[model samples]
Target: MKAGLFIPCYVDQFYPQVAIATLQLLEKLGVEVVYPPNQTCCGQPMANSGFQHLTKGCDELFVKNFANLDYIICPSGSCTLHIKEHLHHDRHEATATAIRSNIYELTEFMTDILKVEKLDASFPHKVSMHQSCHGQRGLKISQMSELVAEPFSKPGKLLQMVKGIELVELSRPDECCGFGGSFCVFEEAVSAKMGKDRVADHINHGAEFITSADMSCLMHMEGILKRQKSKVQVKHIAEILNASL
Candidate 1:
């Protein structure tokens, strides 16, 4: 099946390696992938800042670039969740709806759409999985703590296939990293403190690296890890999945 790659603005700017790994992993899985270079932010920043009106242009532009694709796959849970719930166009409401239904976060697409059972990638490291809020709560990539059901993790499942990789357990599996988009900019102290707490869990658990489906969450924790002069590194799930491929 054909898929369109939707790289979020922060990822496109700061952590482009995650986007490249995502593309490589999907192509390695034998699926045709296309990237819309003209695509920009999905208006998530604007919406999160309470200026969703400014996202109309962004909505229209997204539709123009990704309409008619078999699936729109993004490496970011927050951006994928934004399009799934908020994307709209006054002139092309039907197209907007179709794109929303077709879009999938990277791990969800792998486990649900691709039904990925295995991978050729491997990473020999003590890695901790930081279940980002959007991926956990919004996308349901993992079972929530408050829920009474069988626990599952789509990303964790994929990671299990990687050779020599050890998935470390966290004290709090689904806590927010305090990188609520513009929330970091508004409440810098609270954001940093939350980030430190989140990073501490991984470091204290002997994690050499922290991985997440959402790069924004990783970026926040990366700052904290660096400031504390910690040896732990942050990586997107796609990067580890694409490793050795």
Candidate 2:
């Protein structure tokens, strides 16, 4: 299948390795992937700040670079959610619908489209999973509630398939990590408090490394962990799933 790789601006700079691993993993699965280098920000920074009007040029650039692709897959849930939720064309309704329908987070694409149940990867460590707000709640990629439906999972199940990897459950499994984009800066007090709480829970659970789909969230948590000089570490899910012993 032809896939358009969309690397968010921050991912291209700070977390390029995550994008690299994502591409490698997709290639391993025989995906015909193309990197649209002309592509840049998904306009999420502006849109999330309620200044979506400022991102019209960004949206146009995105549409120009990737509108012709079969499927647009992004490694970051927040970026994928931004495209699915906001990318629109006031003059072209069909174009808006096409972009919305084609966007997919990497995990959702692996589980839903690729139907990959197992992978030839291994990580010899106890790991904890942080469900990013966009991938878990916004995108509804996996079941998060026991009260509503039968227990379903894509993240945990996929991790379990990796040899020498054990999934550790967090105290508040579905709690937000407090890296809600602008929310982090605007509410620094609450954001840091929530992130510290989440990190503590992972440490208490004996997790050597904390992993999540969004590097933004993990980066936030890592800062607090480092400040406190905690032995625990944060990792992106791509780093975990792409691991080899």
Candidate 3:
């Protein structure tokens, strides 16, 4: 099936390698992926900042770029959740609905749609998994620890398929890293503290690196880790999954 790649603005500008890894991973699986030349932000930053009404242009651009695709896959759960829940156009409600239904976060697409049971990738390192809030709660990719249900994770499942990668367990598995887009800017003290705490958890658990599908969260944690002179590095899950050896 044909798929459209929706690389978030921050990812496109700041972390292009994640986008590149995502593209390479999908193509390796023999999927026909299209990168829309006119695509931009999913308007999530503005919407999460309480300016959702001002996202009309972004919404229209999204719909225009992706309406015809069978699936619109993004490496970010935050952006995909925003589009799934808030992408609405008064005059083009049908298109908006279509786009929303077609959007899938990367791991979700890989596990749920592609049914990828194993990978040819390998990473010989001890790593910790950061379950991004959006990927866990918004997408229901795994059971939230507080939910009293059997725990599972699509991203974690994919990670298990990689050779020589030891997935370390965290004390608190799915806590927010405090990089809630604009939440970090408005609540600087709390954001930094939360980031520090998150990094500490991974480091304490013997993680050589922290991996997650959301670069925003990883970026926040990476800044704190660097300041603390920690050896743990941050990587997008796509990078690990797409690794050749």
Local distance difference test values of all predictions, in order: 0.94, 0.85, 0.94
Runs in model 1 deviating more than 4 A are none
| Candidates 1 and 2 compared by lDDT, better number | 1
lDDT of 1 by residue, 78-164 (tens): 999999999999999999999999999999999999999989998999999999888889999999988899999999999999999
**Lowest lDDT 10-mer window, candidate 2?**
145-154
Q: lDDT at 12 for candidate 1?
A: 93
Q: Tell how far residue 8 is off in model 1, in angstroms.
A: 0.5
- Cα error, candidate 2, residue 129 (Å): 0.2
Error of 1 at 160 (Å): 0.5
lDDT of 2 by residue, 1-245 (tens): 79999988887898889998989888988999999888888889888888999998888888877777789888888999988888877676587679889989888888888999779899989999888888888888767864578777677777888898878987788888898999999999999999989888899999999988788889899899999998888878877778766
For 96-211, candidate 3 gives per-residue lDDT tens digits of 99999989999999999999988999998999999999999999998899887888999999999999999999999999999999999999999999998888889999999999
Clashing pairs in 2: none
TM-score of each: 0.98, 0.96, 0.98
lDDT comparing candidate 2 with the true structure: 0.85
lDDT of 3: 0.94
Give the worst 10-residue stretch by lDDT in candidate 3: 142-151
Clashing pairs in 3: none
